[model samples]
Target: MNDINLEKLRVNRGAHAAPKKRRSSNTRTWIIAGATLAIIVYALLPKPTAIQATQVVSAWPSQQYQVLNATGYVVAQRKAAVAPKGTGRVEWIGVSEGDVVKEGVVLARLESRDVAASYQAASANRQVAEAAVTSAENEMQDADRNLDRTTLLFNKRLLSVLNLQDAKSRKARVAASLKSSQASLAAARANEQLAKTNLDSTQMVAPFDGTVLSRSANVGDIVTPLASAADAKGAVLLIADLNSLEVDADVSESSLAQIKMGQPCEIVLDAYPDRRYRAEVRIIAPTVNRASATVTAKVRFLDRDPDVLPDMSARVAFLSQAVNADQQKPVMAVSPTAIVEGEGGSHVFQIGADGRAHAVAVQVGAVLGGVRAVSGNLKVGDALVLAPGSKMSDGDRIKLADAP
Candidate 1:
């Protein structure tokens, strides 16, 4: 009876285990099929393209009147490369780079010991010649007295003819000696002046009131009038009158007619684009560069700041008239990249709040710095796609790559 019960239990366990294995296999197959279906649906769905967007802003009214544009550099009309008068080792420097200097202020000094000594010797020689002149004059006075006495005696027959003749000859000789001494004194004075001038040359001074741009030669460096040798230094320092700063721009000859003396201008430095400098045309070259067909123009700054430096790259916007404070008022503008040429006209892809693009027609105007003025159905706060690429269409959704 016990054996029969054991066999029945084993049969019941086998029956339940077979069905569970089949059920688990079916469940795994269904899970894999569901995953594959979900992937197909995701692959066919529409996706948004990534894009960059920017907001519209106002532009200066004066920018609209810009007739022409040119690029050039800031130049100091009174700049100079201050060099020594002669070759000498630099002993001292009184000014450094960026130091403000006044005209006649000493900027540096060469090893002037030798020149100073020569000047002292020349001064002493001049004094010696002066003393000799005094001595010669005294001797001539004594000779004149003797001659007068001898003449009186001769008239009284107390002196012989030969003695009177001797006295007169002596007086003439003394006068000759005095003249020679005076000539020596004059020559000595001239020598002294020459020595003094040479000594002064060793002490380099500012040629004009300006700011020092660089110190080409330092202490112990051998500086010369010119860098004739490879080892020799040329200029002791480079300086420029900051107040005399101007923009030397190269304007195309075709646009030369747009510029004239005293014409209003807006200057923008490449280094500092945010700062706009008011300027006017100071000179327009009478000739044009044949090779480039560009005319050089000098523009003077109406107001300047310390940041304005020589050699800074700059751009000049020639205006039709002077810009008033109110003319600086902003206008609706967008980046030039936002504009796209179509058969209809120039248009921009303006992004609406609904995440869709709307093609809007615009009248493009003068391009200022990085943006161009555009009159259209747009507001200052409107968002527009930057560099709208192909496949972008009206009502197409976009995923902004960046925040405005």
Candidate 2:
């Protein structure tokens, strides 16, 4: 029972136990307390619904109140299928498709060898007629001199009356010959003009200033005035005045009452869908088509484009009123995705001031420019939930992902 014996007894009695087990117990208690506190905090905090949002914006004034829409084509009011005045083989073509030409510009030429030769001959004959006219005038002058001399001789009794009469007859015959020569000269000049005209007819010229749409004849193709032959080209070139382009649309007879001449219109071409061309009603047909029960109307473009060509498909939006730069007004418009279907009938989940969403009943009007025109208790800058989730409810908190 000495000191050594006491130490051995203390070791066996657990007086030197490891400190790790004690530390582990305290850690377990702390962990449990921390977990309970985190749970309580999460339960008391608000749950924000993550969502996509957009602001209601204004629509274009022209689109804000569209009366009607009709599909049509971009057409040139001043279009022509140009051909030669006379039938002949095409000798040369000066213009290709898409060439801009001025009025009376030579576009093509037909075979004119015969016509040119005839013209040359007529010109030579005209020169000969001029020479004859000059010679005839000289002879007439001589005849006047002879007649004067004969009259003087007859008065002086130096010549017999018969001889004086014979001189007078000679002068008269020369005068008649001069008169006949002048008539021949006049006829020759007329023939020259006619031949020149025929030669000019062999060349085709533009009727007006326009862009060439197509070239129908090759250098060797035969072009005819009447296009009677199967192998002959009916037109040398198809051209149109680009400045005189318009949209020809067919409107249902029932909708004619809603339109009139000089009405403002917005034209959208298929080639330039993003851009809008300002237009106005130019013509309305007096009668309706019995087959389609539609009336044809022409809409003239106020603006022009190089890309716009004849036969290009277009859409015409007949507006309620004219839309000018100063006349455009802001409108309450929302994206199509913002609309929600519910038992309340066409409602929107508008973001509230408190970061919550509240149901707002909207009376939707026209869908314009991919945005819907709506009348509701909404402002221009108000944000609305786009494609709301099923779990979303009235007064539910939401966190906007981004500004639209």
Candidate 3:
């Protein structure tokens, strides 16, 4: 009674519980499978490609272009402070500021009354000296004739020795007086010329072909050699020879060997925007500045500009290759801002197909003016990134900005 009754009771109670546990296990197994499948699908999704970059391009072949990028001042090769040669009062100024002038052309005038008076006085003195010399010569001639007669009489024993001696002394005195008067005349003549020259200084003239930069005096304005508060003095006018216009550019001391006299160059004047003038390296200064270690260079213009004036800002471009099969400055041209310095040294970022920047180490040469001369692995037509940090990488792809 005990085994049969207990077993039947337990089986009837647990039969429902066994099926519920099996169903619960099946639900857990399905949830675990679904979660794993979701993770696998997420990991297998595709990644986004690198973004493309924009770069600026230059028309020049990189190797053929040699640019000497430097800032400079445009200066007239022959600039001068038109000063008075002598002290004088200004009567008139023939030329004004910005007026063009030729050599020896009168530019101003000074009051020459005193100088003229002195000239006349010297001329009068010279005439007096000449008349005195003439009178002495006549007296000497008379005395000489009298002395000759006395000497002949003495020789014939008809004249006394004392009388002949007196006549000879008179002749000698007159001869000496004539010589003295002649010297006085010559001195007077010299004085007259000096006075004339001083009078001539009243007129100012152009020293060379130049443009008047300033007129310190006007008509009726008095100017003197010795500066005075009352007189407009010192530089009466600032004149500059336009024919010898040049750019005084500062160059890095390290780039001296690459520069030479007569090297072809291009110049851009700040006064004349966007116009490039043909230029040549007239001289590389032998001296260097101790502070900046920069050498000042004198560059010459092949074509003179009448409008070019002193102290105008300028830029010189040293060409790397012949601009037109003509010898020119060594300008290795690249995008104006293509040069960027990074860990790999001064380099150009040549964006590659993999959308990364390939930093090409470049040896930069002298920047003659606006053109930057660069050498090393960069080729003429290779695409380079102008903006370094903008979407640039070692192997990044680059797209050109629109034709503008």
Candidate 4:
């Protein structure tokens, strides 16, 4: 009875163990199948496409009409190095760099004590000469009266011929003395005028309405008209007429034919790249530069800004027509390659912050240089995919080729 019971228990345990093993094997098979399925799905999914990108920028409408382009510098057509006419040590500087001055405004003064003293002496001598002329006139008048009386007495036989001749001789001598005194007075007046001129020269004055660019001489520096001396300063101040500011652009000789007087232009300064100035061609240099094969075109600004300074690096765009007030404003622009044309009109793929491309419908306007004007949900600094492929769609992932 014990043997039969033990054998039955063993059989039951083996059957239970076999079913458990089968269950475990089934779970392992399901896990492997799920992992393989996941791998296949991942392989079928579209991957991110690598693309080049460019930034949308503000562009001028005048760029559409640009016929030629050149590079140059801002220059003041009326510029001068102000120096004293008379050589002397600098005494006082009334102005420094960036001081705006009107015409004939005194910019600096030289040591003028000697010139002032000379002028005073000349004035005193003029006074003395006038007094001498008065004395000579009085003596001449007296001599004339005496001669008249002597002539009357001689005619009445009350005076001898010798006395009459002597009276006439005295009148002649006084007249000669008066003439000498008048000549001396004229000389003294001329000397006084010259001395006054010299005194005036001691003050360096502005030749025109301008802003002072630099102060080349100090209070103690010696200034001279000709900068021949090693220690002497030729110019006390460097000044420029801001109103006369213009751009001197160098255009290739082959492109000179397209430039004309009064041709409208857009000036972009390197110092202020965001700003644009309206300008027109003022002069086309008659001669060509032999070395550079270029001609200088002088362009005058129509809209003046105080910040426009001399020698600022600039780029000029010579336009076929003038830009009006509305056209001067900047418009959103993108590279031509960035635009994609389809049956639904023009659109651009703007990369979103989520690293995905979003299609933005745009209304294309005039072409601005190498870019095209577009108005849409775009801004000046939005990144746009350049030369998007036909397969590119909205919500596609993008990898920037320019990224490190």
Candidate 5:
């Protein structure tokens, strides 16, 4: 088969054919050109410039500032339920809801009339016992004298032995009776003291200087013991020291690390939108609430106002940095869009006085609202790159959007 093919077949070369590997070489050249064109197109695409970016200088009252935000309710720092210490029917309300009273001032009274009457009865009984005790003392003295006489008679044998023995027995009986009367008097006095204690407990008094939040009881209303029958008897009055106020905030567990005792905070109440209260973090609960993935934080106001009422909705911001009155200074700020990512870190492109774009590295801190506080390489009045697209580069020419 090889001999026949060699005799009859001869290969033909056409114009389309070229020198050895010419097709491969041409294909490689086209590939290179296409790649070059792609790069050129990419480079030519229109992009934003420094003029497009809105920039501001770095200046802030304090460089380090933290605004940790959470929401909570205002609570009374010192709250108490004004309930009767001893249970009884309420007789009179000396104070009503919204009434402000001093500590130890009676807000209400129970039906202590029965207790008073019982005390009086106990007093009468005590008086009778005292009288009996006096009689007993007289008898005791008589008994002692009789015993002495009996001893003398027995010693001298002036009286019969049976008569002396009878005299001694009579004296002993009178001494026992005197002792009994003394015990009765003491028991009556003890009963009177206990009754007085119960009667005194029947008076419900304000535990501290506070305003009554509620008046749970009125004349003739029955109140029971808080421990034994609290379910059946709710608190008679909710009193709280309004001056002692606190913020009970719930912070997410992830942000709990930022919280600590004495951390400065800014609290805004929904009830008062225009006002802000200065506060400090007083407690950061160590235990996390597993179910809610939150932690309870308590804050105390450095300055309190009476208008800040309990249960007011409040927003809390725990600050890692604080800005005191003396430390407050104005910093040039711009829209957040002005900042951009650069080689080593964050940078900003600004339009210089000559109206040229320049990339400068900037130290960035907390991002708030739509502005970022920046430091280094920028100053007030410098034109910042609002949002320079990919086409922007250092040393690039720029013009403000509305420039002539």
Candidate 6:
């Protein structure tokens, strides 16, 4: 009986130890299953895509019709460096930079005291010559009468032949003196004209209607026809006809075929990027630059702007058609790649503040340069994704591949 009880107790102890081992094995299995589930859940979550972005910009409607684009500068076709014809010291200036002048307007005056004095002296000489000529005419009249009387006396035989011969000789001498005095009067008149011309040269006048760009000479500065001397200025005023302002743009020789003399163009000055000017091709240079392989195209403005200036950096867009008055204003534009077409129509994935892309519905309009004009809940400088993939959806997180 004692051996039987000990055997039963040993069997009970083994059964209890087996239950503890099974419990520990079950605990480890549960822990491994929980870890597997966590891993699968992590794998199913959404991942961010690396992408590039562009900003919405204010663009012109004319850009849609752009065939070619080129950079250049505003040039005045009627530009001139106005200088005096005769060299002299500058005495007075009547205009400054930015002054508008008309044709033949006197801009400055040189030292003319010496020239004026010469003119005055020549005038006095001319008057004296006139007086002398009058006296000579009276003397000639008297000589003619005396010769007639001498002839009559010789014919009547009332006077000796020697007396008549001496009277004739005196008349001939007086006639010769009259001729000499007449010649002197002509010479005096010529001298007066030359002196008057010299006096007129002392004043500088405008060549055409233009705006003064600069005043190169000041009071007491020497001005010369050619600025070869270090102390002499070549031009008193740098003037340009603002009406003749044009853009000299360089176009590639290969693209020159598209350019036409009457073709319309849009001009945007670097100084005023927001402003657009209406222009047209005025001239196409017949020659091409061998070094740059480019040809110059001259563009003229259709309407003049007071702010447009010479040599201001500019960009030219050669267009297929002219922009109307209403289309001249700016419009919202975006890259074509950023637009996504769907059953719901066109939309763009603009990156929201939360780093996720939000679809903004857009009504796509004209194609501008490399971008498309769109009207929607968009503004200038809003970030949009470029080339969104098929898997991309609304509210999907995105990682920027580049800084916006």
lDDT of 3 by residue, 331-373 (tens): 3556546777666577777766664468788876544334466
lDDT of 4 by residue, 1-404 (tens): 43566655564576589889999999999999999999999999887889999999999888889899899999999999999897899999998789899999888999999999999999999999999999999999999999999999999999999999999999999999999999999999999999999999999899999999998889999988998988998989999999999999999998888989999999999999888899999999899999999999999999879888899999999999988988988999999989999999999999999989999999999998899999999899999999998989999989988665
TM-score per prediction, in order, is 0.72, 0.71, 0.64, 0.87, 0.61, 0.79
lDDT of 6 by residue, 17-79 (tens): 988999999999999999999999988987778889989998888877899999899999998
Which portions of model 3 show Cα errors greater than 4 Å?
1-63, 226-231, 325-404
Q: TM-score of the candidate numbered 5?
A: 0.61
Q: Which is the winner by lDDT between candidate 2 and candidate 3?
A: 2
What is the C-alpha lDDT profile of model 5 across 262-344, one tens digit per residue? 98887779997656667888888778889999999999888869788899999887776665764344555666677777668
TM-score leader: 4
User: Hey, what RMSD does candidate 6 come out at?
Assistant: 9.4
Error of 2 at 372 (Å): 4.7
How far in Å is the alpha carbon of 334 misplaced in model 4? 2.1
The candidate 1 region of ten consecutive residues with least summed lDDT is 1-10
Candidate 5 contains a number of clashing pairs equal to 9
lDDT of 2 by residue, 1-404 (tens): 53565555554535446576798999999999999999999999887888998888877647865888998988899999998778899999999998899999899888899999999999999999999889988988988888899899989999899988888898888888888888988999999999999999998899999999998889999888788998987888999999999998999998999999999998888887667778999999898999999999999999777878888999999988877864344468899888876766787899888989998889887777679888889988898999886667889988877633
The CA-based lDDT of model 5 is what? 0.78
Name the 10 consecutive residues with the lowest summed lDDT in model 3: 54-63
Winner on TM-score between 4 and 5 is 4
Residue pairs in clash, model 6: none
In order, what is each prediction's RMSD in angstroms? 6.8, 7.9, 15.2, 5.1, 17.9, 9.4
